[model samples]
Target chain A: MSAPGQAPSAGYAAVFVHEDVPTAEVDRLEALHRPLADSVRDLVDATIRTTVEDEEVRAVRAEVDALVARLRARQLDGPAGVRYNAEGRTWSWGNAVVGERNAVAPPLEVVRDPDGLVHADTVLGAAYEGPPGMVHGGVGALLLDHVMGVAASAHQRVTLTGTLTMRYVRSTPLGPVRVEARIEREEGRKVFVVATLGDPDGVTVEADGVFIVPRWAV
Target chain B: MSAPGQAPSAGYAAVFVHEDVPTAEVDRLEALHRPLADSVRDLVDATIRTTVEDEEVRAVRAEVDALVARLRARQLDGPAGVRYNAEGRTWSWGNAVVGERNAVAPPLEVVRDPDGLVHADTVLGAAYEGPPGMVHGGVGALLLDHVMGVAASAHQRVTLTGTLTMRYVRSTPLGPVRVEARIEREEGRKVFVVATLGDPDGVTVEADGVFIVPRWAV
Candidate 1:
């Protein structure tokens, strides 16, 4: 295993180290980042709906900018590039679907079943809404895309989404919902997945995806 | 047409008003919001890559929390429901795909062709990366979903994504790209659309979608 931040000779972007910090420390960091992400999410929802006086909105924007400057005072010069450490653990805390630091992502926690199905439960709050009270259709697909990709990539093999088809069974209300995906079949480099998004009432979206093992991944 | 914030209720969630602010004002607001959203996006990217001391991260978090509180001090009690006035223009500033208020959305400007095609051009940045240096697979799907949905909803009719299938032909690098979608066929409530995402080099993703006009829509 390579040391932290050290890429194997393959290339910085292509190297997938089978290692990372101890699992315990990674867990601690995830916990630490969660609430911050939560607050930012709240900020997103609030910003969308805030009817604050225009002057007040400007005032708040200035303050937020200052906070941004402070945070930017010390930062990595580039993207967070996937990182793994000596413990054979990989983490991409910046991923749009599951990134721990991404407030824009719904608070989704996906679990893979013993039989290879992947499922996650989350609430699509105001920040995720598209039509009035409904979850954005694309957001539903985004969640499904990730979970389905996860299903296709089970067993430590990397796969990229080649094509995905989704069916909106109904408009998903912006609240608690479940997403599940399972590998339907595989043909050489292509893995097929079937997935669904549901409210407590019933399934609202159904998706089928073809995930490809990229040449680099192979 | 109803007043701002008033739904022409066939049940609020199902109604799509063909009205809103004057095009001039809408354009003004979009311009006004763009820089703020751009900054927020930068903040998101920086947050993910920050390697500050733990104490510094915590301190920054505290400052960010204070900013959040200030913004939340006066806010809407609920989600930003879709609203339109009587100007025959519609805007959903909080929409997940094209909402001007949504910092998480790439700044996509979709144009419908005279021949009924829909296309948009946007640049994906570090914040949207999944694989090292490449656009997140889900992000590609997200872009295609919206464009295809638009294609299905052409002619002042409303349609929701019923089924969307996407194929990732190659890794989409983070940078300028174009997306185009057009109706392939229609059957009753079902609208079929085909789409593609591509960089300057060539197509990277192709998608086909099924969009449906709900019973309420007709």
Candidate 2:
């Protein structure tokens, strides 16, 4: 991966890497990393709400820095770009929405039904809050975008978000939330998708998006 | 803050809290917590790229867990809702976009120009990747939504996102990015705003949004 500000050699091919790791190994890695990500997620919430004394906060920071140093003892050169194996297994452990190793990602587990609908159920915690007790509006869009991309890319075809429009029907309280998406239609390389983000009561935000298969992917 | 699954007593007032904290104390608290948040952000980036041995990873997890415990020794009952001091200083320490103590938030520092335009410059890191080596499309929307809200709420008025539409003009690589927003017009309770998310080269996503000042505020 390129350093944060240095541009990578530009192209979709460079972004999507073929590692050919076996499916078993991919699953193994997921199991190894998911628990760590979960703990980090908890740490994030604690950091936000902690009423510890100033001295304790400073002490915790020192401990966190040490752990970070230990992790950095061996590190990847850059971002964990998406990778796929020969058996058609794909893993993007660094994805901002559903990466198993991404602590910042909501704990979203997306399921694709036989009828081509993609959906996920997750708990949006304090870290995901936007307005007071409501889910952040952009966080709603982020979940919808990722799940809609899944709907568009079902059957192993890759697609990128071309455009997204969200209408806020009501405020989604930050709690148990659901996101559902399906392909509405396709025009050549552009796939139209409709999605909804909601709490248990009903839909709070509805979205429609265009996902395009890049020319290289096509 | 409400539990992860329970609904809070609903209202805009419930979300925004006035603490009457002195400005000097607010500044002192910010100085104390900002560095901790900064360190956590670095830890997140390291977590994504770490390639340590399994034993080392496990050890780091244990250490991280301990730190979390220390922080959680005392805590806020809920999310850090937006708070304002008597001096008119506002702080939303857990804001998903600009929360000073939020590790999950990108390091965005939004500024209002002399003429009322709002803008920010920040570095998007590995934790923000969507496509290979690129900024996640939803992340673009997230930054735009918050900056546009800043523009809409200039002069201390509170607003919520009513609708947001993002057009991805090009792929934004993960790195230094700029976002700019300005209010386009207003009608009664509705504020219209336009914004852009871009790399140093040029714009990648363009957005126009409707923000509503709730009836209670009006």
Q: Residue B136's C-alpha lDDT in candidate 1?
A: 76
TM-score of each model, paired residue for residue: 0.87, 0.93
Error of 2 at A58 (Å): 0.7
Q: Enumerate the candidates' DockQ scores in order.
A: 0.46, 0.54
| lDDT digits (tens) for residues A1-218 of candidate 1 | 00122233333445343444787888788777666666666666766766555666677677667767776788767665577767656677777777788766775688988998799998877767677777887788788878887788787766666667776777888889999999899898888889999999989888887777656655
Q: A1-218, model 2: which lDDT tens digit per residue?
A: 11111122346555678786799988988888787888888888998899889998888888888888999999989899888777767777898987788888985788999999899999988888777777878888888888888888876666778889999998888889999999999999898999999999999999999988767656
Clashing pairs in 2: B1-B78
Give the top-scoring candidate (DockQ). Answer: 2
> Where's the lowest-lDDT run of ten residues in candidate 1 chain B?
B1-10
Off by over 4 Å in 1: A1-29, A187-189, A214-218, B1-35, B187-189, B214-218
Instruction: State each model's CA lDDT, in order.
Output: 0.72, 0.82
